[model samples]
Target: MPVDSLPNSILAHMLAINNVPPPPLRSLPRLRLSKTINYGQLNALCHIRGLKSDQHSSLRLEAHDAFIKQYPQIYLHEKTVLPKVPHLADKRKSAVRLAEKKHQPAMPHNISAYLREARGGPSIDEEEITEEKFQEFLNILKKLPVYRTKHEHNMVWKILKNIPALTSQLSKEDLKILSKKVMSETWIKASTVTGDDGLYVLLTGQARRRIKVFRSLIEENDSIITSLYRDSFLFDAELKDSTVAQLYVPSKKLTVKKWGVFGSLKGGHEMNESDRSVVTDYDCEILKIPAKEYEKLELEKVKHENAKKLKLIRKCPFYETWPTLSIWELVSISKFKTFPPGHVLVESGTVISFVGYISSGYCNIYRNIVGLVDLPINKVKKMKKRVYMGKLKEKESFGEVSILLQAPFTCTIITGREVEMAVIEDKDIQGKCMNVI
Candidate 1:
């Protein structure tokens, strides 16, 4: 029977009788034989096809002899068998093409457009940014301290130019807000300096309604001579010694209790008590108004209160040593609290958790005295002997040493009269006010 007409099982049995090799049996593309056929049956199929088997291996011997004759060195050193199938050269060519394609330089569309513009090619039109938006951007740039230098300003411009969204279709106010946000996120170290030019302009303006005069006592033989202007005042009538043509700057050590209407004429100089002037013989109430209050009045009437608070702060010995920024921070965190006469502000041996500044009225300090027997009938009877340490008047601060040292109060502070004090708690200082300066 023809092989095509026979069953696969019968075909396999017939091939086994011919001694064909199993490998050659599989190489027959047209034949579909049983997968379960034994190796002996596959070997028989090669014999039946007139292909070489183990029993007749003369074909392999002939190929080996031909290879030895063609390449003697390879045949002498290494025993090798020639492959039945040839390798496709086209596969190597395809692989080389694939590798070249992967390594080829290809620019993205956006980058190409940028390059084209740089080369002065037909430029792509960017989305139009409004003039208002640009102005707002400039304002933010002006506010930043780092942008004061030309190089930093250019760097900022370059960055903004690269960001298409920042330049395209954002509103003026929105752009300003977004730019500030981006600046804060990117340059965390950058700080903005608050402008006080408006405050200065308001103080120097020619509006009499804006200025207020205050009277202060200048004691006899006092070395300090306070004046609105070092050389000359705009309101000369306000000064007690108006005849003096050559006005002198207040001594750096002079402690100015009240600022003249024009403030200190000499800028950037601090006045203290140790600073003496040429004329201090007259004992009269000097007329003056705080410049800080005058400046604040231009912004808001409520801010005028900050001037009094600032004055009080300037008088305190502890606050005098602090920087201006630190003083501002302290003032912001402190709140005013009032106590009636005979009220004990802090008891001896209690935890010192806060500091207080005497804004108004007086307070007395009493130390705990030992060796004095006391009755426990009432709260006042427990302390039979109390030694008065000192008195704290307006503009004085107490409890700072205890609070700063993180210790208990060494003495009891009692209100001698109805007093108002600015209290700054330790929690508030550490939590919100610390490191601000």
Candidate 2:
């Protein structure tokens, strides 16, 4: 019988019954073995027949008594232990002692060995997990402390659980709903209220892909998530275009929270927070124009382009104090550019390298003000992009301030709608327009 197979109490009695060899002389408790038996002989006997110490004897009876008292309606089986301690040298005693302190008892140390003696050990079987049991396990995990917050670890698990490759048995609509839930509450930005433009653009793409892949994984769970998470996806997962990677199979599970880390490693493009400034609402001085005054400035600049013929610059309350230049002369003095709807024109902190003048088309200016605007003001207020005479706009210019002051671009400029504007370069404006300044 294996040493562990015998009950410790029964093994003790059996050892007493046999003329068993004693423990090693140096390590032995008070008793010494007769010279008739050597350490080798004692070891051989203990290998064939098991022995137990007082602590083990008491533990065995306690386990039995507790089992019997609780499970009177159920039958209890005989206990067994395997004698498989590997021999190690004494110099490792410190490490071995530490490990012994942390050791946990195993029920069947080896399933194969226990199966061979199934008629003897504890009554539990070597059970195979079923689909239902897997789901039950998942439910239990959902209730664990780890699942409460929207952490990357927890999000990954939620992704795996909610997706269909593992749960095709679930409904299509159910999977769609799960995908929706993932997006609505998953990874959120931890930085400024106005997102970094670079990060915002990248995240916009990521959010779209996460939603799509999450949908596809569930739709074709059997062939998709399994292949990707368990097989080939690792090689492709780090793409900044997460949507592309998500479309491909996972081969292995993704555990990282920050998607960019994976994207950079995979040779995907990275956008720095500096690049992401487009998302922020730039702080700009507002230039509100009366309808008639704005209309007159638009007519002269757009129609004649003759700075000398421009009456508005000479007559207007806003532009009168401003240094004067002729209409055609102003065109020569400034550079011109145009933007259509949805175009990002200027960014914050960028050198207000040049001042702009709106010749035509409506324009709007904005700054990031939290608890104020939900969407971009142009979108929410339905405002057209306009040139601010007092505030910065198409005909209105800014970079001159920096050139005059020799500072960086103080504010960002973005197009609210398509409009044509002139950029008055510092040299033309300072050398010529400032001839009047």
Candidate 3:
């Protein structure tokens, strides 16, 4: 047999052994398959392996499931095991639970039980006992009659002072343990507990080191406290402004009587009313305009001054005593003005006569080409319009640099379109700085 016909011959022999019937030549020609898969051989292999048809099918299914689980996408799989999904913490419920745990009230444990057990318990005075046992002793002392009497005499007494030479020997954690004992013992009977200051005083009895650290912490929170007070004051003032505004309207009489609630004073300017004890009356005429209008103008002025000061602070580097721009200086020289489109406020290489701050418009700052003025008509028409290189927008500053430096402007500053600006002369800024120098 030819090399290729050997497999067909083997297949014929295998088919003969298996007693498979031969088909017509036409049908036999169409039955081409892999020469390795002879039915008789396959049956013999299956018999030798002791594999059932159903078992083979089940093995194939398991192989596919294993492949999918192991490879996942076969494109991107996690290189490392991911952390197991965690139950999300419920913040609101957790906070409520924590607060309840904190404020649960310090009910004294059974003192009778403690006393009966204490008679047989190990003595706390043993020098060989650990620092942990000393802490326990301090906790027990807080409940004893002797310590309770000592605390009432001075509720804010220091704990470390009671332990001879403790300050030199104990660690910060030990001190914290002592503070906790103090907190629990005093908190139950605390009268006139106010703020962190009171807490510090009660903790350490105003120890110099403790008080210094506490003051630093309190001062560090100054900005946060200031922000809160500012918002609260503004809210109250806004309410008063609204009431005053409504009352002073054309058809109504403006009236508000001064009142007091303990130390709290109301009506008139708080400052003026503090010096006198009369029911101050606010009149529409006294304000020189409608109360609402006057208050609105005052608020705007105050806001403007604050913004200008903030800008100055941001622009200038911090010195030992860096100063903000004075409102009086701004008021004396700068005035808000609008420029029409194509208005030339300053020319290139010319001294900046008046520096302008963009209040409500866009302006371009660009380098001037030396030979652009000599361009031919055709070339000029073909040339691109000069690119606007830099833009100044609302609240953005420009034009002060050259004037302050007393030098010619290095670039041409042109209005992109209609613009509003607050103009100030170079001399005005110098005058303001002179006072500081």
User: 1-437 in candidate 1: lDDT tens per residue?
Assistant: 24464444444553553464333555434654333435554344334432233535776455434433332121123347886675578788888999999998895568855753453222423344355654454454444544445554444354344433233333443333233222321111111111121111110111111122233434433232334333232321244563323323323332222111112322212432122111121221222122343343334533555666677787897677777777777777777788899998888998767788898999999998865444577423334467999999988888766765668888898999999888889888767764652
TM-scores for the candidates: 0.29, 0.23, 0.26
Regions of candidate 1 where Cα sits further than 4 Å from its true position: 1-301, 372-384
Q: What TM-score quantifies how close candidate 2 is to the native fold?
A: 0.23
Between candidates 2 and 3, name the one with more favorable lDDT. 3
Per-residue lDDT of model 2, residues 154-175, tens digit only: 4334433432222332344333
Tell me model 2's lDDT, rounded to 2 decimals: 0.39
Segments in model 2 whose C-alpha atoms lie over 4 Å from true places? 1-303, 307-318, 322-331, 368-399
Worst 10 residues of 2 by lDDT: 257-266
Rank list by lDDT: 1, 3, 2
lDDT values of the candidates? 0.49, 0.39, 0.42
**Which of candidates 1 and 2 is the stronger one according to lDDT?**
1
Give the clash count for each candidate: 16, 52, 0
RMSD of each candidate relative to the true structure: 25.7, 33.7, 24.6
**Sort order, TM-score high to low:** 1, 3, 2
Residue 353, model 1: Cα distance from true site in angstroms: 3.3
